[model samples]
Target: MKPRIIMNFALIITLYSALTFYIGWNGWIWLHTAFGLQDKWIFGVILELISFSYIIGHFLKGIPFFKVIGAYWFGLLQYAILFLPLANLIALVLIYLNLPTTTIVKWVGAFVLAAFIVLFLYGSFNAYSPVVRKYSLAIPKNAGKLTKLRIAMASDMHFGRLSGISHARRLVREVNALKPDLILMPGDIIDDDPEPFIQKNFGDVMKDLSAPLGVFGVLGNHEYYGGGIPRYLTEMNRIGITILLDQVTNIADSFYLVGRKDKTDRDRMPIEDLLMNTEINLPIIMMDHQPAELKQAEKNHVDLLLSGHTHRGQMAPNHLITKRMFEVDWGYLKKNQLHTIVSSGFGFWGPPLRIGSRSEIIQIDVTFV
Candidate 1:
């Protein structure tokens, strides 16, 4: 790595360590004072393990328990970092007011625990209960004999350990029930690893996803991160879902379905280059993982653009950041002739919790006039 890259990585490590220490220190204080927990060494060891479990999980991929702890920790870590300081401040105020330290600690701990429990329950519900987001539009172009097209698009399924067979079954059942003519998965079909997906036999559940126009997906950044493109492709292909990699296909000579490699791909073909040989008259529906370069799609005359990858922050206040980052983080955006619909995602990453955004599948009804 270059010197700057090394410096940045070191900085990140230092910050993460400092934050972990702060959280650990606060947690220790709470436990010791509130519950009279005397075992500091045991507590310290457990805290260290839990705090860095995800990083350790990366090294020890065979042990999924660490990964699970790490994932949940990551989710808790954010909220803990956000609220712990406030909790500490509240404790400080109680002290200033001459309230009993033990009483204050106990109450504060109880409140925080209750808050987390509620958040977990609510967030889990949002993560699991997917709703169909419907969109209807018309294009002044013809798609051969096809009058209307019902497209079922889902992105960031992140099928893995957390989002296991049950989630896959739900997705299959839901999408199949929609009876869409075509199914498009914009990206993140797997969650950073194809091992869990393949090992757990998720494809069996996913294979039940039915669409007459066939199921198509593209690589998300996670898929790229997993470095299992060949394995993922083979499995998807076997299950009858085509994983498009910077390729375009003519759908029954009616319209074009263009799939681009994730934006992470440095060599990903430009929109203009991808559409170079395509007929200008036919309606073109494109899928790119991240919702970047909206103008390019519009400029290239893409009739519709489908994407996911944003997860719309997946959690609250985070969506605020995502909104500023992307032109259309989640939902519809129309620029000239291009219609873009970005799904919050069917499956989630990390915590399987969604506070701001609900897990969703996009049902787009397009009529070619």
Candidate 2:
């Protein structure tokens, strides 16, 4: 790695370690005073293990228990980082007011616990409950004899250990119910590892997803991280779903469905180059996993662009960052003649919790003139 890359990585590690230490220290103080616990070594060890469990589980794929613990810890860690300092500040104020130590601890602890519980409950509901977000738009170009097309799209399914068989079944049931003429998945179809998806037989559940115009998908960054593109493609094809990697297909001579390699792929073709051979006269619908290149799609005359991968930050306040990161982070955006629709995603990444965003599927009704 380059010197700058190494430096940045080191900085991230240092920051994570410092934050984890802060959280652990506060937690230890709470336990010691509130519950009369004095075993500092045990607390420190456990905290460290939990803090790094996600990394451990990621590399050692055999140990799923660590991943589960780590996933929940991550959700807690985010809120803890946000609220813990405030709790500490409040405690300091209480001390200045000459409040009893026990009373101060009790009040702060109770408030923090209640806040965390409410966030977890609400966030869990938002993560698990998938909603259909509908969009109706018109294209000036004609698509053969077809005047309208109903496209059902779900991106960032991230099906793995966290989002298992139940989520897969729910997705299949939901999309099939929509009875869309076409189904498009803009990616992150599986979590980092494809083993869990295959081992748990999620393919069987997903194979039930039905659409007459067929189901198509492109890879997200996560797919590249997993490095199981060939296997993922094979499994998806087996289930009648096509994983299109920088490829285009004409759909019944009506419209073109273009799927691009993720932005993460260094060799990913440019929009103009990818469409060079294609007949642009037809209504062209394209899927690029991340909504980072809307201008390129619009400039290339892509009629409709589908994407996800934002998750709209997945948690609150985080959406603010994503909003600035991507032009259209969560919903629809009209850039000139191009119609871009980006879903918040049907699944999540780290924690199966969503604060500001809900798991969603996009149902787009396209009318071609």
Candidate maximizing lDDT: 2
List, residue by residue over 26-128, the lDDT tens digit for candidate 2. Answer: 8888788788898999999999999999999988889899999999998999999999989999999999999897889877987888999999999999999
Residue runs of model 1 more than 4 Å from their true location after superposition:
none
- lDDT tens readout by residue for model 1, 332-362: 9999999999999999998889998999988
lDDT of candidates 1 onward, in order:
0.92, 0.93
TM-score of each: 0.98, 0.98
Q: What TM-score does candidate 1 get on C-alpha atoms?
A: 0.98
RMSD of each: 1.0, 1.1
Clashing pairs in 2: none
User: After superposing candidate 2, which stretches have Cα over 4 Å from the reference?
Assistant: 1-3
In angstroms, how far off is 199's CA in candidate 2?
A: 0.4
